[model samples]
Target: MQVKEEKEFTIQKRRCLVVWVYSLKQLKTLKRYGLIHYVSRRMKYVVIYMNEEDIEQSEEKINGLHFVRKVERSYRPDVEMNFAEKIGTKAAYQYKEEEGFEVEEISTQIRLAENV
Candidate 1:
């Protein structure tokens, strides 16, 4: 005579995209498209956080941009590291440093979405 309750998963699976752009001019375009989590001035790259599905939908368009160098998919291997850990890999950091930015003080601006 007992009823079982079902649990719901309201959280969506989101992934971080490390997008490399040749120039800051493309920032306007990216801003217009939305979904950017943090923009790093050091490497001329921005970290975009979005539901995996949404990224899949726009991947082609973003990758097609001549200004965009690459879009790296950063994922979590375990819960220990923070969100930015993926991009903090040695190779990635080296690339940023070679670009002339102080790796330790890589500047980033966080963007908040009012309507996510």
Candidate 2:
């Protein structure tokens, strides 16, 4: 007869966005909490993945720290949203999502906001 033991791991089901902070101390604080696997940096934003329920609490903690910039929830496109549109009127159309002007237009809007 053979006996086997199985180890169970806790699966994280919640998703979140963590803004990247410029302070080493702040990063250390977040790392100390065993939450350092999901960090993404874009421009001045740091996107992190965590439980949705912990977003507000985590943002509050990070904001309370020094040298941290404004914290706001980051938005991601829904996977279910249909995004397979061809960009031009050609017989051999291509699914060039990036070729579309949506993101560029949005970026222009953002730049305009910065000027205001």
Candidate 3:
């Protein structure tokens, strides 16, 4: 009997680069740096996803381009994404209802004052 070997698939960690540009025409040049994830026409920015290992070099090269106004690294990777610990905690559900007058009561009070 022949044994079948299973191959492991690995996903590379990618980080987003937010590049603000003067014009969208030079997008071809930006493609060489990383995978273009999103391009915002209205805001004039491009979101590029690059492998974590190559991000530093790509960031410098992308920033040196003439059309690029600024390049900012996305902080998504650094942020805490785990909410499992806090999900069932008492503190998480203990939000106090804001003490404010109800709209119906306020309207009734206003009507009574007008009639007086």
Give the Cα lDDT of each candidate.
0.76, 0.58, 0.90
Model 3 CA RMSD to the hidden true structure, in angstroms: 9.5
Candidate 3: residue 4 Cα off by (Å): 8.7
Among all windows of 10 consecutive residues in model 3, the one with the lowest summed lDDT is: 100-109
Residue-wise C-alpha lDDT for candidate 3, range 1-116, written one tens digit per residue: 99999999999999999999999999999998889999999999999999999999999999898999999999999989987675767666565679544445444334566687
> lDDT tens string, model 2, 13-113?
55545565665445656653235555544444455566766777777876776766767564552344443454334634656667664434444334566
lDDT of 1: 0.76
Measured by lDDT, the strongest candidate is 3
Minimum summed lDDT over a 10-residue window in model 2 is located at 101-110
- Residue pairs with clashing backbones, model 2: 16-50, 18-48, 20-46
Score candidate 1 by TM-score against the native.
Answer: 0.53
As a whole number from 0 to 100, the lDDT of residue 28 in candidate 2 is 57
